[model samples]
Each structure stands twice: as C-alpha cells, then as structure tokens.
Target: MKIIIISYQKILFQGNIISIIAPGYCGYFQILKNHAPLISILKNGFLKLELESEKKKIKIKGGFLQVKKNMVIIIL
Candidate 1:
C-alpha cells in the first residue's frame, strides 16, 4: 500500500509500505494490505512503517489519517 505523511512545511514520507502502525486517538492500530477503509484521529506519538526488508518510525505531534483503496495519507 502507498503511504504519505505531510506536515505544514514539508512532506515527511511518501512511499509504498507493507504495513503501518499508528497512534490513534483511542490507541494504536495497524493497517495492512487490502484493509478496510478508515479515517481516524491520531495522538502525539510514533508512527511505524514496515517496508519490504526494513522498518521505520516517525514521530508525529498529532494529525489525522485517512485510509482508502490501499492508500494511507496522514496530515499533521
């Protein structure tokens, strides 16, 4: 799935990811390939991304996330 993370001043990340774990308002949640569409409010915490052979973590102050059609977008 494609993932994009953007802040007011820059694009933090844009690439294809195997999976992702984000700090949702209620708690942390994971998104995988072909997952159902969703929209959620994020908390101030870490966002984790899984790549083909590596994993990455991004610190997010707070933001919103939208997932649809295997695409995830986060705006902070």
Candidate 2:
C-alpha cells in the first residue's frame, strides 16, 4: 500500500510500504496492504514502516492516522 506521512513543516515520507505499525491512543496497531479501513488518534511514540528493502521507525510527537483503499495518511 502507499503511505504518506506529513506535517505542517514538510512531508516526512511518501512511498509504498509493506506494513506499518503506529502508536495509537489506546495502544499500538499495525496496518498492512488490503487491510480494513481505519482511523485513529495517535500518541507520542514511533511510527514503524516496512518498506520493500528496509524497516524504518519515525518518532512522532502526536497526531492522527487514516487508512482507506490501500492508502495511509499520517499527519503529525
């Protein structure tokens, strides 16, 4: 799936990822390709993504996430 991570300052990441794990308000959750639609509040923690070649972890202050139709958008 394609995912984009953006903030007021800039776009942190924009690419196709195999999976993603993020810190949700309640806990942690993972999103993979073809997964169901999701929307959630995020907490201060890390956003982990599995790309084709590597895994990346990005620190987030706090934000929210939206997933739909194989696309994920994270605003921090």
Candidate 3:
C-alpha cells in the first residue's frame, strides 16, 4: 500500500509500505495491504511503517488518518 505522512512543516514520509501501526485514540491499530478502508483519530505516540524488509518509525503529537483504495494519508 502507498502511504503519506505530512505535518505543518513538511512531508515526513511518502512511499509504499507493507504494513503500518498507528496510535489510535483508544489504542494501537495495524494496517496491512488490502485492508478495509478506515478513518481514525490518532494520539500522541509512535507510527510504525514496514517497507519490504525494512521497518521505520515516526513520532507524532496527534493527527488524523484516512485509508482508502490502498492509499493511506496521515496529517499531523
């Protein structure tokens, strides 16, 4: 799936990811390829991204996320 993470300053990340773990308002949730569409409010925590054989993480204060049609967009 394709993912993009942006903040007020700049785009933090934009690329293809195998999976993602986001800090939801209630807890953490994971997104995988072909997963159902989702819209969620994020909390202050870490965002994990898996790309191929590599894994990456980013810290977020808070944000909103949308997932649709294999595309994920996160605004922080």
What RMSD does model 3 have? 0.6
What Cα-based lDDT does every candidate model obtain?
0.96, 0.96, 0.96
* Local distance difference test, candidate 2: 0.96
Q: What is the lDDT of residue 37 in candidate 1?
A: 91
Q: Write the per-residue lDDT of candidate 3 for residues 1-76, one digit (tens) a residue.
A: 9999999999999999999999999999999989898999999999999999899989999999999999999999
- lDDT tens readout by residue for model 2, 1-76: 9999999999999999999999999899999989898899999999999999999999999998999999999999
State residue 41's C-alpha deviation in candidate 2, in Å: 0.4
Residue 15 accuracy (lDDT) in model 2 = 94
Superposed model 1: Cα runs more than 4 Å off: none
**Model 1, position 17: C-alpha lDDT score:** 99
Task: For residues 8-75, write the lDDT of model 1, one tens digit per residue.
Answer: 99999999999999999999999999999999999999999999989999998889999999999999
- lDDT, residue 4, model 2: 95
Candidate 1 colliding pairs, count = 0
Model 3 error, position 62 (Å): 0.6
